[model samples]
Target: MSDSKYAFEPAQFKVICVPGDGRCLFRSVAHGACLRLGKPSPSENLQKELADELRAKVADELVKRRKDTEWFLEGDFDTYVQQIRKPHVWGGEPELLMASHVLQMPITVFMRDHKSGSLLTIAEYGQDYGREDPIRVLYHGFGHYDALDFHPSGAKSKLFQK
Candidate 1:
């Protein structure tokens, strides 16, 4: 992706691709959680396990915050939560928001600008948790999400330098 709109070279960030199974969103978030904590990336098997664990937590979070979330949900809130608890179910924006609450950390989502070929910040969650050192994830605009982390050089882009 081009970095023309920002002050960092593209090489400073690396995308950690996860399996495109229906749990991609959760997998991406799990991977990002590791990076946010300055921990080494988890192995593929561990990533899947973490994703499933996170999916369960997110479901509980949605239920716990039902008063705030149910209104915007599409179907029976109970059913939605039950389905989301399953391992292979897919998650979208709603789940992403709930993830922020569950993890109590900020998540920054980026999407590739199709026309400009640059990455754009499409959505951010968990501002109350603070904006520093957010977990970054890239949305493919299809049905996939991937984790984005700093390269070994530990460089901070101007966009993120604050």
Candidate 2:
């Protein structure tokens, strides 16, 4: 049985669903992070590149700390690096950090637990970032994402009809 038994009431909000390819996490992060960029970013590919760079920075830091690349990755570090640089692979906290840095805004990820009936922030950047509105994303899990739009009552959006 799936642990995702409970769910948010669909009628209460609009859920923007993105592609479920291996890159969904990065794409969602990119959308939220780009809102405060002052101008639009060229594409999702650029944000993916930013995430790859962030991971590379982490690898460099680990090397500086004398940790072998294998400690945090598999096979050859260079190959792994190349793989992540391309699209489709998932990115986690490191990418979030990079997105936060690149956008100069805080990112708040809210993760919901149907089992426990709760929701909370899974990641956050400090308040020092200059932007007015923080970029926020709803993190469904390691593999998927979702967004809720609070439409006015009695207005049924055709896009999200049950």
Backbone clashes in each candidate structure, one number apiece?
0, 1
Q: State the lDDT of candidate 1 residue by residue for 1-162, as single tens digits.
A: 122233223445677888988989999999999888888999999999999999999999999999999999999999999898888888998899999999999988887666754567778889899988788888888888888885535364443221
Report the lDDT tens digits of candidate 2 across residue range 1-162: 012322333343444455666565555655555544544642656655644455555444434433433455666766655665555666555455555555456766566666753445565653468434556556777667643333436265453431
lDDT of 1: 0.82
Q: Specify the poorest-scoring 10-residue window by lDDT in model 1.
A: 1-10
Best by lDDT: 1
Superposed model 1: Cα runs more than 4 Å off: 1-9, 151-162
Give me candidate 2's TM-score against the actual structure: 0.54
* Shift of residue 128 alpha carbon in model 2, Å: 3.6
Provide the lDDT at 91 for model 2.
Answer: 57
Instruction: For model 2, give the 10-residue run with minimal summed lDDT.
Output: 1-10
